[model samples]
Target: MDDVTRQKILDQIPVIDYIPKENSQAFLYLKRVLHWQQTNSKNAVLVVDDSSAARSHISALLKRRNFTVVTANNGVIALEKLKEHKNIKMVITDLEMPEMNGITLTNEIRKKYTREQLAIIGISGATSGIHSARFIKNGADDFLRKPFCPEEFYCRITQNIESLNNIAKIQHAANTDYLTDLSNRRAFIHNANHRIAEYVKRKVSYCLAVLDVDYFKKVNDNYGHDAGDQILKVLALYMRKHFGGD
Candidate 1:
């Protein structure tokens, strides 16, 4: 960040302290606001290691900071945990462990996980030779050496989690239709059977309409593309607003 941006953030921390301790209401209000950010982040960091002690240590550190943590002893267990809890947005693995060492774990994950799937960080005692580079080549988003500083570890973890979230959002937008903000026809049908089961089980009514846009061809010919685009946006917004916003 530039000097100005850094200075602005530095300024805000001191200002937050200026609020009087006597004002209990203001303190409660601000505290809730800060907690809401943590809640909505919904970030989960999975600490995978053969050692239970290592897993518990990392889990405790993150939990104290308000992030959710999951632990697994081996690669097989890790993948099962991932499937059981789809919101595990990040994974931190220790290399040179038992069955399903870091490389094997990463390879399995990369097979099913796109760039949007999950952010994986590899931590190892062995940093020399190809050990560190192998982790990166096998889809590790970041690498950390053993005996790292607390602050540096926190920074790298935060960066990887944030990066994964942003990439997932972009991929979602690209695959979805902008006008309706829903999956396009092809995307919708990619797993239509799965999506439709809920509606069928609930016995809910749905309507499929063949919309013609009320002479869209003529509208485009008369008003040009910009106006036509605006019409689509307006209609989509109206549909979403009244129809539970998808």
Candidate 2:
């Protein structure tokens, strides 16, 4: 903090000195903030394998890295676990499971989650090249051979998760307006065209409208660009409130 800000906070300390530290409002607020950070900082990973040893080993490794781990014995249970745990960001599955193999699990997961939403990494003991090939073809972000070293395992997990995060960042930057934080013209056109195609394919009725802000140029001319930006932000909020679903 700068000197002014630091001194201002220091000046306020005397005002609350009479209160016990444990009962102080500032202390309680800080405690809540810290707790929230601790809770939210860890991304959850789902580990699926028929072998108990494999699940336990993977879970242990992930937990050591501060990732919250959920385990399942097979793909069926993994699907149920995914439904139960909404925080699960990634899945690491073994390919030789009984109920649903990792390939089938990856395909099923893709039906609901894009790679940006949830990442999948397949692991198996098989020496055949086809396992890794099929895993990737079925929406697995990456694949690892069984008995992977801790370094290799962690690297794969980190890379896949980072790839998903980077993709999400790129997509947000591409689709969002910088000033108003609303959908940009390119995003609107792309999405509208997609919806139009779908609606036409299904022979469904649809409506499309373009909204123009009147006197926008006048506002910028009269009040400066900053005021015009504020106006645009307010208009964006109103649109989000009224037409967000559409």
Per-residue lDDT tens digits for candidate 2, residues 1-246, read 365654555355222112134457858645643443354335799999999999998987776556788999999999999999998999999998897999999999999999889999999999898999999999998999988866578667767766766797899999999988887889988989999999999999999777799999999999999999999899889988988842
lDDT of 1 by residue, 156-218 (tens): 866676677678788778668976576677666764666678778999876555666779988
Q: Could you say which candidate leads in lDDT?
A: 2
Most accurate candidate by TM-score? 2
Error of 2 at 177 (Å): 1.2
C-alpha RMSD (angstroms) for model 2: 12.4
The whole-model lDDT of each prediction reads 0.75, 0.82
Model 1 scores what on Cα lDDT?
Answer: 0.75
Q: Residue 105's C-alpha lDDT in candidate 2?
A: 94
Q: What is the Å distance of residue 94 in model 1 from its true position? A: 0.7
**Total clashing pairs for each candidate:** 0, 0
TM-score of each model, paired residue for residue: 0.63, 0.65
